[model samples]
Target: MQDCHILITRPEPENTLSCERIVTHGWTAVPLPMLDIAPIEDAQQRAAIRSQIFDIDTFQYVIFVSKNAARLAADWLDTCWPMLPVGVHWIGIGQGTTQALLEAGIPAISNPGHTTEALLEWLKPAKMKDQKILIIRGLGGRPELGDKLEERGAKVHYLSLYERKKPHYTAQTFFMLPDIHLIWVTSGEGLHHLSEYATQHKPEWKTLPILTPSSRVNQQAKEMGWIHASCADGADDNSLIKATEFHIGKQHD
Candidate 1:
């Protein structure tokens, strides 16, 4: 993997972690961000958030869906909660999100694994029944987690903190492909966004090897004509690194 160039599709700021890990493998990390997180500006959504600012304590559990969600929740908490509240359980969907909460000085936090399914399994219906839960997430994500929680008799609420947007490229992004050896797709949305960008501009870039965080994303890459693709068994940094190492090892072997 020495001198290998790895491209990261996650948005800026948050993409730093993946970049750092790739560099640790002695690979050049290229950040061609596929998505940028922006706050939702809808007047109705903003007004609703403002109105419910005080009701934050009513929820028994606050779930941070991603590291971005944790950062947003930390910002909102600075204005609303100020000091950390007791008795409210904070659940981070993955290790990255859990670490984000820890960095924010949030003491009581739990993360089952790195995916929604793991989190849902950790939250058994018997334990969650009748409990009030607030899910802090970005603009668009799967509703399965929320739907399942509600079906189990929990009252679920969503506080969408941001939206993922495509970045405007200055030069042709396709020209940057030759130097890229491996690419990490953090989410299916990021993969789709990158695919859309290539479709309109640089169809040649689709041949690069891509590492996905989930099977759904890996399938999306296959449909997009990616010649080489791999999916991490789990979404944590360790699993992602393991997947990348395995692929690179296989290539050299």
Candidate 2:
């Protein structure tokens, strides 16, 4: 069988990681970075971020929403605090986020599952009625986590550590992949960005089989006119690769 050409739409570092794993299966992995994540570089904004990092002890619990959040928040903390704040509990939402925290020398706790909803469910045992919670993430993300915590009587504060920008790709982007067999998207936002890039050039993309990291994104893909989107259950390389092999085999059969 010929190697399947699969497009990986994650940001770099992560994109590279996923591609490395995908190629081990003898599939051609294409690196098409959808989001560019970078720390907030504005002088005033930098100062504000540093202040929030330094004062994390004020919050009862601090949550890192993504690997980028944990990494950038740790970078800011490395500048000021010789020692991490003692009483502030560090939490990460997913395995990748937890691993990033651990790599940055921050001790963090993670639940079995990934997602804001899972984190909230795991934190049910931890009383937060009168406590302050801090959530660290990229700029302009969903307010669901904070809003849910607020509903439970916790005062939630957000520390914007970085920004996730969609990389500009011409409509000709999709045309360049002449032999592309499949596309894997980890998030709804990535699917949206990819769709926008394909708009002017391809107009319709319902025939191509798409692999999504989760059912939520799978539904989003279907809602946006994708007729053959399959959920891989998770974004890690194993899940995506397994789903790809299965879907490709099913197509041939």
Candidate whose TM-score is highest: 2
lDDT digits (tens) for residues 177-245 of candidate 2: 656778888877888888777565665555678888767788888888788888887766667778888
Candidate 1 residue pairs that clash: none
Clashes of each: 0, 0
RMSD for all candidates, in order, please: 2.1, 2.0
Q: How does residue 29 of candidate 2 score in lDDT? A: 89
lDDT of 1 by residue, 1-253 (tens): 6788877777878678778977777878888888888877899987777656567788899888888888877877777877877778888988888988999887646645677877888887898899999888888778989999999999999888788777888456566555667777888888888888867766666887778877777888998887777788565668877888888888889
Query: Which residue pairs does candidate 2 place in steric collision?
Result: none
Best model per lDDT: 2
For model 2, the superposed segments whose C-alpha errors exceed 4 Å read none
Scored by CA lDDT, what does every candidate get? 0.80, 0.83
